[model samples]
Structures are given as structure tokens and as C-alpha cells.
Target: MNYTLLNSIIVIYVGLIAYLGYLGYKHTNSTKDYLVAGGEINPFIMALSYGAAFISTSAIIGFGGAAGAFGMGLLWLTFFTIFVGIFIAFVFFGKRTRQMGQNLEATTFPDLLGKRYDSNLIRAFSSLIIFVFMPLYAGAVLIGAARFLETGLGISYITALIVFTAIITVYVTTGGLKGVMYADAFQGSIMFLGMAFLIIYTYVQLGGFTNAHVLLTDMVHLVPAKLQAIGHQGWTSMPKFGSALWWVVISTLVLGVGIGTLAQPQLAVKFMTVKSNKSLNRATLIGGIFIFSMTGVAFVVGALSNAYFFKNFGKTALEMVGGNFDKVIPLFIKTCMPEWFAYIFMLTLIAAAISTLSSLFHVMGASIGKDLYESMITKDNRGSQKQSMFLIRTGIVAGILLSLLLGYILPISIIARATAMFFGIAAATFLPMFMLGIYWKGVTRIGAISGMFTGALSSIFWLVFIHKKEAVALGISQAIFGKPFLIETFPWMVVDPIIVALPLSLAVTIAVSFFTGNTAIQPPHLKKCFEGIG
Candidate 1:
């Protein structure tokens, strides 16, 4: 509608990002700088980068849409985002991870585990998992941003995806960790401002906060019959406890991403980007505030969007989005917000997508270059440092291509489910090893490997064969089992893989460690992982 002003804002945003990328490229001279910013990142930058990387377009566009469909009950995830994702992650996990990563000279999440246990197989396996599965998560982020451009600005979806991917790949491929984090910090600021204004303005538009929520509560009778059959209650309240929608929202969306955030390889590696514990301690406040505003406002606004749409258009947000939940926020912004605010918020969405995409590509590249290929070459005494960096750069390109392909092919309304799937898989595969490796001296290499394999494999199996999203989408269960899903039981069809996979992984690790008779070889470097221990 207002092309001139929108174009100017975009140009300025792009220029600022390019300048940050230049600074990153200038500072990044060696492999160490490329991979971990030489372990000397500013505390403020690290905190902002961590928060930005963690809450991407997937959270704002994807999960926000989910909130619009499912209701304000999604606020439980906000609580978890603050307490678990920020506070506990920084205080408990971040401190130990940084200390151990520094002690072990580890540059990646998989490298930390492999070095901690002195097992090359563990490192390579975990890295391979990242190289393969991370694209699904990256694709979700790509789709979220791309969909916004397509829906809000009338850009071609293919053009949006390619352009977004191209810009991010350039900065990430050149500037490395420094470039990624610097850009992330700037983008995070934009996102924080955009979401803050969004929530405040939304409330003002729909009367006061209390009146808006009360109106929403009164619209429970307007819910679709199909949704009610599946347990959706009201926009202002939770679904029936233990109902199908309840299980999907709680077990899949909430627990999947909430608890799963602890083991995120991309985010975990951020702990090692800084120099000391004080940086992490300082980060806690920044990270907490960022996550709270980002997620809290998103959920509140998303749920309120339904009310806004219903009142204005006499139709639900879901109906307006044409069954594609991911389009709800973009549609809201395009139709409701002032033209200038719409342009500014467009930059915010782009920032969110680019920040997360940069981190994902970096992690994917390092996993392949430093962990998989480099580990093999070093094991055979044939690895050159230059060759390792080349391999990682190659991996970054490959990862981006795969994600672009997935973004093109994935079905509509898949952003939230796809995001959950990645987080759940990461939690199942890596959480046990990461948590125990940091705190428990008795954790054996064999135990960790077994848990890792079991967790990863079982999660994939369940997703492919049992989870409703994949099964129904692929038509595999319908073909094989004469049903939309393989598991016909209640809650099973709705339950996320993490609920089953994570516990089995934890149990297997503990059992294997106990049965194998605490013959753990605690090397000096490994012992340094735990402070005040022999």
C-alpha cells in the first residue's frame, strides 16, 4: 500500500545488517573466531543472540498462530520459556557447559559430549543427527518468514524464501559466529520493540485488556464443532484436561519445546561463546526479559487476534487465514495495523528469521566440518585445518539448500508442529547426555552412546510411524493400518514423541551406567567438568 516508506525502512535495515556482518568478518580471522567468536563475546551480545536465536519467526509467526487457534493456555509455554529456557539454562546449564567446554577446548555441542567422554563415535553420531534433522527446524523458520512476506506484502513465496535464505547465508557463510551473533543482537532489539508495540496496540484497538479478554471468554460458543469435538474450549482458557487437543497443546507444543530448549545444540553452543561465568550471570537477566516479552506478548496477542477478527469481520481468525494457522499474525498486521507500523513490523519478522537462520546454519556447518569430517580426518591423521574450514563452509550451503527444499514442500499450517518435532527430537537425543555429562561423574561413555542412539532412533520411528502429523501427512498409517494414525488409542495419537522418547532415553542411560559397573574412566579434563570434585 505504501511502497516508498516500506522500501526505505527495508533498505536501512539491510544496510545496518550488512555493517554488522562486515564487523564480524573483520574480527573473524581464524577457525576459533569462526566457530565460537574466540570465546570472548560481549555478555550483552551473547544474551541477546541467545534469546534471538531461540525465539525466531517460528515462535512469533508459527506458535503465535497456534495460540490464536488453541487459546491463551499457550501462556504456560511463556512460564517455561522464562524459568527453564532462560533462568535454569543460564544458571545451571550455561555455567557448567561454559566451564566444561573451555576446559575441553570444545567448539560445538557434539564436540563437548565427544570430548567429555573421549568417544569419537559419540561426536560423529550426534553431529550427523544435527546435519540431517536440523533442516526441518530451519525450514519452519524459513516458512514462517516467507509466509509473512507472501501474505502481508504480496511477495511470491518462492522469491521470499530464496531471498531470505540468500541474505542470511551470505552473512553466515562469511562472518561466522561473530557475524551471526552481532546480527542476532541487532535483530533481537527490533523484535523486542515490534512485539511490545504489537501487544499494546492490539489491546488498545480491542478496548481495554480486561474488556477484550472478557469478550473473548464470551465467544466460546462460536467455536467450530470439529474443534469442540477435539476438546477446544475457549480462547481465554485451557482445553479440557487430558483431552486430545489438551494433550497436543501440552505434551507436544508445551513440553516439546519448553523442556527441549535445554538441549538445543545451537543454543547450547552459545554458552561457550562467552569468556566467563559472569557473562552468563549477566546474560540471565537479559535473556529472561527478552524471552518473556517475546513469547508472552506473542501468546496474548495471538489469542486476542481471534476476538479482533470476529468482532470486525464477523469471522474467526482461523476462518480468515483459510485453515492455515501460520498466516494469522501476518493477516492481522497487514489488515489492522497502521501502514508505518506494518512496515516496521515486517523488518521485525525478517530480523527474527535471519537471526535464527544464521545460528542454525552455523551450527549445521560446524557439526559437519568440525565434528563429522574433521573427526574422521583427525582420527586418521589426515585432517588439515584449512580443509576442515572448507568442509564446514560446504556444509552450510548444503544445509541451506535442504531447508529451502523442505520449506517449499511442507504443508500449510505446519510451522508449529514442525518446530515441535525438531525440539522434541533434540531433547530426546541429546538432553540426557548433556544434563548428566555436566553433573554426574558416573555417566559412562557407553551409557551416553546408548542413550543417544536410543533416543534419536525411537523419536524418528515414532514420528514416522506413530505421530499423527507425519502419519496423516504421509498417508502411511492409513495405507498400512487403515487409519489416519498407527496408534488408535486416545492421547497416543495426540501425544508428542518426546513424552515417550525422552524418558526411555533417560532410563536406558541410567540403567546401562548402573549395570556396566561404574568403571568410568574419569580423565583430568573430564574431572574438571565438575567443580569442587576430586
Candidate 2:
């Protein structure tokens, strides 16, 4: 591969995103415009922006790495993403979210929930959680993309990180949500197309899908002895039931991401960017198709990479990637694809990274400015558009710096786990509150607060005190619980914080609402939310 050409393509790609950001800056005139694109984004851009944010470097590099380590069993995640994350999300949550957001005139996730409950505390606290926890997710995404560049293009990790982060931050800070959405639509298309091409090319290079599978199966004994001891036989096949690897794949990777999608603040906010239920409906097919191709191809190619490596290097794909796990797909592309295709794939990877990063940064800024700064810190400051925009850009810079620092210090081995931890926390804390607050009138501020607190704390506690890696890192003994948290007893996985916290939050909200006699006044705007939507 000509290094100069690769560098040139990257520079050109980033230049286009900057140009889009400049256009967005021209259109941004108010606080609402900065935060939610003035709620005028088209359904197609909304759909692609949602997809791009959802399918990040974490999904492609991190999950593909998991597939390399765990086998095709992780494919269940791809299925859940289409059926649960997209199909159900669009049909059930999308329209109501848009309607309610518009009714309340909200610009961020925290603002939506806070206004729905008439509680500034809810808004401020939720903003704090997002600002604090989002960096871990952001850092993980940064690491995944940077690792790919380091492995595939022989670039320094620091250089890759800085370049990728700078480009995303520039557009996000300048153009806000509108710029991010436009760039996401373009980048998302590249990701979808690149993944499809990579899958087809990988199959062809391995002598078709059937031959690839057979070769993968023939090398079953090549599975790492440690993995074999835990029942993993090969990269192409599923792990044996009731094994450690099986549990990790089922409980953590599949459920973590699938359930986590519903609560992702960045993705959920996209549902509010468009105007009507019809817009959300139109976006459903686009989002579903995008996810199916993007995630589906990543898992399929990840599994098949075993064949590529086994044939060429006499070792498994994971071995070739130096146990970094995230490098498997990038390495496969570098070794198997033509130089030109590799160049295209590099653009796709960068596009995936930058698109997701931009959205994350935008959501974080909105959370701070609209939810906390305006509502709580300056409760009497009378919502001035200029002041709000100033706070938002300030938050954007602060967020980027924090994420960069965390990415530098966090251990690479647990980056995937860290990413999963964030998703799990979101699922536990926000999913129940959002779902019930919209559908169930009995959801009081007290109940919503209780649920968010319980879910967020319990999930973090389990990850830190009970997870093997965290336990070891913190010098805590896991034997205190007799096994890893959620790995013991029936319904544990189902009762994991997300499951427990959500229902508990709902139950508390209902019980408390009834006990308190539904005393709080419901805003007239709340009723208007459902009007004209059915």
C-alpha cells in the first residue's frame, strides 16, 4: 500500500467533513439549532445518523474482535441489533420520543426526561452521569479505531488518535448536531458499503463461504488451549454450552449491546431530531438495513478471518493480532485485500470512528449546556440562545479533553469490558425511566430518580467489585460472592441490574405514584405530545 495515498485519502475525507460543518455553522442560528439541528433534520439523515452513532468503532473493531475470540455465537448480537435495537426502537419508542421532545421543547435526553417529570434535579443529575460516564465509552471507541490504524497502516497509535479526535472535534464544536448528522449520513454510507464489499471479498479470497467454513472447522484443534479448556473448539463454530466462554458471549457481549442500545443517550436523542411520526416511520427501514449490513458483515468477516490467517500464517487470527483482539479485522483486511481496497477500508474505518465520535461529543455538549447549565446552574438566567450556545461549545472542548486523557490511561486489555460497562449502566439507568415515563402516567419523579440511581449504582458495583478484571485491578476478592456477579444462579442474567433496576424503577414509580395520590400537576404540554401522532 502506498502510504502517501492512504494519507491523502484520510486528509480529503476529513476536509469534506469540515466543509459540511462549515455549512452547518451557516444554518445554526439558535441554541436549538446547535443542540438538535432545530428539529428540522430529514428522516433519511436522522436514520443514518442514528445508525452511524450506534455502529461505531466499538461495534466493528471491538465486537469483531470478540467474534474472533468467541466464535460465531456472537452473531446473535447482530440479530438482536436489527430486531430489537432498530425495529422495536423505531416502532415503539421513536415517535413518542419525537412528540414528547417537541412538546417540551427539549434539546437533549436529560432535558426530555427532566421536562417530562417537571424536575430540574432529574435533568442536572442525569447530565452529570452522562458527562462523567460517557468518556469511558468514548475512550473505548478511540482505542478501537486507533488500534486498527496502528495495525493496518503502520501508523503510531498516538498520531492516529490525535488526528481522528481533532477532525471530529473541529466539526462537532463548530457545526454542532446538524454538522455531525450530515457527516454521519455520508460516513455511514461508506461504512455500510465497505463492510459489504469486505465480506464478499473475504469469502472469495478464502475460496467461497463453504470452503472457508470447512477450513475453519478443519483447524478446530488450533483453538487456544486455555479456550479449549473452557470449551471453545474453533473460530467458526459455537462454544460448548455452560462454559465460561459461552457465558461471557451470552451474558456480556450479546445482551450487553442488544439491551444497551435502547438506553444509549446518543442514539435515543436521534428519535427527537425529526418532526413527525411519519418521519420516524420512514427512518425505520433505512436504520434496519444499515445495521443489518454493517454489523452482520463485521461478525461474518470476523469469523472467516480465521481461515485467512490459518492458510497464510499457520496460526489463528487472534494469534496474529498479538492478543490485542481489536486488530483482527484490520489485520485480515491488510493481508487479504488489494492495496486499493485497503485504502477504501481505511476510509471506512475512519468514517466509522469519526461519525460516532462526533455524535457522542454533540450529545455530551447538549447534556451539559441544555440540561445542567441552563436548567440548574442558571435556573434564573432566562434561556438566552447565545449564552446557551456558548456553554455548549465550552462543554464540547471539555468533553474531548477528558475522553482523550482517559483513552491514554485505560488499559487496552479491558477496553471492551469498559465499553460494555457503560452500555450496561445506560440500559439499567435510562431505559426503564424513558420507557415508563412516556407510556406510564404513574411514573413520578421520585420513582424515576430511584430507578436511575439504583440501576446506575448496582451496574457499576457489579462491574467493579464482581467482574474478574475489575476485581483483580482493585485487589478485591471475587470469592466473596462465590463466583463472578451475574454468573451465579437462575435469573441472575435476567435480574442483572438492567432487568432489576428497570422493573424496580417502574414498580416504585407506580407504587409511589399511587401512594402519593398522583399529586403532581401534569403539564398541558405533556398531553399535547400524543396529539397528532397516532
Candidate 3:
């Protein structure tokens, strides 16, 4: 792996990151500056920062490996990520969130919703949810990067986990959101250039774009027996509808993360950093391009690695990695690309990891330090600035520790699954109320509370007892009922929890809001919420 060259690269990358973090520290002068960059971040930097935070090693390594195994069907996720995650989020959600956040003087996401609904319970509970579960997503990202270092650098996975965690904890804690965004912009640029080069190099290796996919379609028979029974039609074609594979690909991988992007506290908070609706509008194109380059190239290159492996090694990508798809992309790069290119690509993955990890830790810190601590401990929504920063720093450290622990504890091939699990939970718990809170004048405090609890509890219930994948692994249902899942039926067992929980949440929010009426929020406060909307 060329230790001398690798060490040189690490020094350069870490140096750049330190400089950016210092820049972020200098820019942060207050709670607002630390949290949202004082709401004056440039559109280009915001777009890149958001895109970088959104696409981490989880997308490049975990989902990319899934593409190697699942085929081009993952492209649908790329489409949704670009369209719904960026377009709808910015056009429909961003403009309003920025204005409302500016109006309410909200810093954190929990604060944004809590202030909007005028309920401390909403703020506190939302803070707890983000603080608790965001680590799972952070852990998934950590695992992806740790595995890459383990594969590429021959470093121990635990060493990678601890070292990277420490670096990012300091980076985020000292620099705040400004530091995170500045570093993210740098990372995002590397990700773009690396991925752009990868796709071009990949197509040349596998003949041409047309021939590469044709070869994959023809290798349908190469799919294993276990996969064949489950619905392995072909790499190029969709999984057979209603099959287990189809359910997993559609519900968990595609819909779970794709739709879940909207309510992400880390990403949503980025919208509040921009100054105007026009910035959000302009950001859409840049963000779309960034996401497309990151995810699109990843899935495409991953799917094509199978062809390259089969032609030379006479095995599929999954088989080459000994059935651990998490190792697929790293192994492919190590074997196929030039040594110089391989080292460069490793930075791309590292950047993805640092960008997302820093953001996750930042959001987790705010959830606890700013939202939960202020609402629960201080009793005033506004707490001492010095004390709040102290708690936030503590939260970032604790979040990093928990995330690193999970990175070590989780099983292989868990990168994509862990990520989707957090996304699905976040979607079910927050999205219904979030969507209504920002858009609907009639949404009441009680309704928001009811909907939020229902979504959160129901999603947990489904995971613990109903969703076969989670239920079996978690063993909660097995311990209680002597069955892995409550229903072992074909479709029910495979369905993602968000599919059921989100609708129930939305239904309850709407019904409860009408039952409570617009009087739930006082006229003046409600008027303040929608003040500038036409």
C-alpha cells in the first residue's frame, strides 16, 4: 500500500482539515454562528456542504457494494436522492424553513420544530430522538470508512474507528457548523473529482458503457442459488415484484434512505444557514449535480465491478469479497485501479466519511446541548452561551464514542442496512409532523405531539416485533414470543416499517389537527409563523 506515500497523503488531508476547522472557529462568534453560520452562508458552499454531508462512505462503499450485488436497480435511489432529496426539499421545504427559522430565531432542528409548534415537549422529545438514533447512522458511516482503512491501509478496524472519531470530534467541536461546512466544501470537491474519474476509467476497463451492462445482463446465471430463490432476476433487471429481494431493495434501500433525506436534522439544518430563498433556488442545481456525481457514479461503478471481476477472477464482486458486500468497492479499487489512483480514491472515501461524520456529530451535539439541555435542565429555552457550548462539546465527544462502539459491534454487510434503519426511523418519527409543521396552518400542538409519538412508537414496535430482518437480529420478538417476527408471512415480514408508520403518522396528524382546530395555536403566534407567505 506504499506506506510512505500513504503517510504523505494522510498528512496533507489532515492538515487541510485542521486549517478549515481553524477557519470555522474564527468565524464562530455566537450561538447562532456556531449553529447556523449566522444564516449568511454562500449558496455554493451550502450546496456542497449539504451534498457532502448527505453522501458519505455509506453511499460510496455500502450502497455501492449493494449495487454490485443488487445491480442497476439501485439507480432508482439515485433518482430519488437528486429529485426528492434536493429538488422538492429546496423548492418546497428549504425556502420556508429558512424564512421560518429566521422568524423564530431557531438554531437547531429540534428548536425549529419546537418553536414552530410552541411546545417544549415537542422540542425535548425530538432532541432525544436525534441524540439517541443519529449515532446509528454515524456508526454505519464509521464502519464504512473503518473497513476501507482496514482494507486499503492494513490498519486495524478498531484503530481506524478511534483515530477518525478523535479527529472529527475535535474538528466539529472547535470549528462548529462553520468549520464543518468549510471542511465539507473541501471534501465534496474531492468526492466529485474522484467519482467523475472513476466512472470514465471503469467504462474503459469493461469495454464501453453499452457492452458493460450487456455483459452484466448476460451474467444473470452467475447469481447464487440462495439469491435465485429469493428473486435474483438479473443485475440489469428489477427484482421480481413481491419477492423478498424486491421488498428489501424497494422498501429498505431505495425508499427508506431516499425519502428519508428530507427530515434529516443535519441536512435540514443546512437550509437554515442560507440567507435567502434565491440561494436555495440556486443551490438546487449545484446540489443536484453533486448528488448525481456521488451516488450515480457509485452505483454504476459498483454494478460494473462484477463484470470486471468475472472476466479476470471468474467470480462475482460479492464472491470476491467473501460475501461481505461492504468490502466490495475497496477490494475492487485495490485490484483494478493503478496504485496512484487507488491512493487518491481512498481520500475520496475518507472525505466522505469525515464530511458526514462531522455533520452527524454536530447535529447530535446540538440535539443534546442546545435543545434537550436548554428545554429540560435550564427550563428556559435560552441557556447560558458558555454552558451550552460546554454541553455541546460533551455531546459531540459522547456521540463519537457511541458511534465508534457501534462501528466495532455491528456485523459485516451492515453499512447499508444500518444507514437505512436510521433513515427509516427518522422518516417515520419526524417527517409527518415536520411536513405538516412547515406547510399547514391548521396543524395543532396536540396533533403534532400525537403524530410524533405515534410515528416513533409504532416504528419501534414494528422493528422490535414485525420487521423480520430487524426482529430476527435484535431477537426481541424471539425472546418474548418464541418467534423471530410476529408475522412470518411473505410480504408483511419483509415490508419496511416506515411504509406503515409514516401513513399512520400523517393520518393521525391530519385527523387530530381537524379535531383540535386552528385554535390550537393562538392567532398572533400562528400569524407570526406564516407572516411572509403569500
* lDDT for each candidate structure: 0.90, 0.80, 0.90
Per-candidate TM vs. native? 0.97, 0.93, 0.98
lDDT of 3 by residue, 360-409 (tens): 99999888877887777546555578778888888888888888888889
User: How many clashes (backbone N, Cα, C below 3 Å) per candidate?
Assistant: 0, 0, 0
Q: Give the TM-score ranking, best first.
A: 3, 1, 2
TM-score of candidate 1 versus the correct structure, residues matched by position: 0.97
* Candidate 1 deviant stretches above 4 angstroms: 379-383, 478-484, 519-525, 528-534
Strongest candidate by TM-score: 3
Query: How do the residues 1-534 of candidate 2 rate in per-residue lDDT, one tens digit apiece?
Result: 687887788789878877888888889888788778889899999999899988888888888877877788888999999998999898988878888888778889999888888788888888888899998899988888888888776879898888767866777888878888998999998998898889889889999989988887788888889889877968777777767677677667777778888888898888878988888889999999999998888887887788788898887887888887778878888899998888888888888888888888887887876678766555575567787788888887888988988777887655566677788788877888788877876666787787778777767676655555455565444456544442544334322344445566556656766665354765565566555443
Query: What lDDT score goes with residue 355 in model 2?
Result: 84
> Which residue pairs collide in model 3, if any?
none
Which model is ahead, 1 or 2, in terms of TM-score?
1
Model 2: residues with Cα > 4 Å off, grouped in runs: 476-507, 517-534
